[model samples]
Target: MASYSGNIDYLAPNGVKMLKGIDNDNPERVYICTPLDVNEIKLERHPQDPNRMVAKMRVNICPLSENYKNVVRRSAQERGNANVSVPTHEMQMSFSVGYIKSVAQKFPKLVEQVKEANKERDPEIMGQDPTDENTHLFKAIRQRMNKRLAMLYQPQPPQQPSPYATPNVGVAGAATGYVAPAEGTDPLAGFTDADVGDLPF
Candidate 1:
């Protein structure tokens, strides 16, 4: 039986800290243990600090042979698996941190270089002459602003009244003043107790 192990630091809400330990007897069935419940998981930034955040997750364990067989069957059903063979243990474990430390260490430097190149490609503009009151671009922008102001001041037009503003005569014709009933009017009006009749036996 092969064995694997690793550790991961995960942030949690309400200033809670979570640390996970991964352990597996077979490469495909890794077990991840943490303090968080599998349900009610949430991902959010710390209330006091925006830069830090919590990421919720769930873990699963599966047999290596079963996992591989399922993958092959899925591919065959979906895209026609071409009878490709699975990788050896050594090849499968090549992604382990012990095997890829040097590559990982250079990631930060590569990110910094990329950021510097991006900055150079989109350099920021500074005011020309440092001491001059105004530059050519500034004067042109000011003149365009004045022309826009003059055009805005010259506008003159009145809008017509809407057709819907008039009251609907057809609907208004249906309504009439309510009339009070005369003194001897039947208290029950058109209804009779016979409508309710006798209860069924």
Candidate 2:
């Protein structure tokens, strides 16, 4: 019930390919990769299509890992209540635009911030009881737009030097486990060999 003609500004000149498959002996595909920065991406209502929208990528920032394929199969016993099962791939064939606008795109950062906030989770400032909904751990998850990312991420303990790591040494030193003497230390203090070398008359 609408009319329009021309290039849609909301579509990238070269849109991203989010999926690939075979159709009619020719390769077929879909375009729906997540933009790194939402502010750089634009979604505009289509002119002729009332129910459709155009997503344009203002810049290219897609990473390699997001384009790979992973398949998963869950057995009925693992699923807890299912008698039927099918393997699911990494990307969904059909995606809801409204849900994309409201939830999916906003989810990754939400989890990141919650993880960041959980790093600062103190039972004293929040609550001591694990069941208490007033805790920062519980509250941060509910607050979707929480900017608690300023909280420090969990720090990993420093890795100790590997016990099996090879030490630098000459061939003989390696076999004998000879450590280089430190500065100001005698190098030949432990030598028990005869120092008189062919000096007999």
Candidate 3:
């Protein structure tokens, strides 16, 4: 099993909220959302016990809702902005050896990616014992994990811009299907019952 040496305890200073009424069977409701950014992992002295070290990382994410996405798109269009970003918040979380092992089991491809990144960053990591905390390879693996997480969670925007604008496809064609939103109406007015999901980083 893959593992790290640092002690870690799960901590969410400003944790994501659990979906209110979905998945009643789950005591801990876990939802899927999009992560905007994940800061590089670092070892910090434990806040409660300075003598011990723990892994820490910052995650910025927004809850997933079809209506929320639509609102973002609509707002961007109103401002004539091409690039759009979802409303996001930052949260702090910790990683432990158990987390690494679980990731290695369920997400082996991630481990493989880390190995490749480690080799590119420091070829010596390929030969060093990964289990040893004193070795650079250990730190390299942690950094690689950060890289993989960022790639996996970052949101991907639309390739084409049709949804933002009704292209000039002749006057008759444009008028055929375009119905502009009200000047001062709630973008999410009709999506009050939309299912909101939490992004697990």
Q: Model-by-model lDDT, in order?
A: 0.30, 0.32, 0.42
User: Candidate 3, residues 50-150: lDDT per residue as tens digits?
Assistant: 98777446543323466856887799989999776553322223344544444344443444455676677777766665555577765555444432222
Candidate 2 error regions (>4 Å): 1-17, 22-26, 31-132, 143-201
lDDT tens digits, residue span 1-201, model 1: 554332222221112322222223333332232222112233567789997767543333223465766675577767766653332211110122221222213233332332344444433212232112254322222222121101011122434855633322211222233343465543223333342222100
Off by over 4 Å in 3: 1-92, 98-109, 146-201
RMSD of 3: 21.5
- lDDT, candidate 2, 134-164, per-residue tens: 5554444433322111111123344576564
Give the Cα-based TM-score of candidate 3 against the true structure. 0.28
Ranking by lDDT: 3, 2, 1
Ten consecutive residues with minimal summed lDDT in candidate 3? Answer: 169-178
Which candidate, 1 or 2, would have the higher TM-score against the true structure?
A: 2
Worst 10 residues of 1 by lDDT: 145-154
Q: Is candidate 1 or candidate 2 better by lDDT?
A: 2
What's the residue-level lDDT of 96 in candidate 1?
22
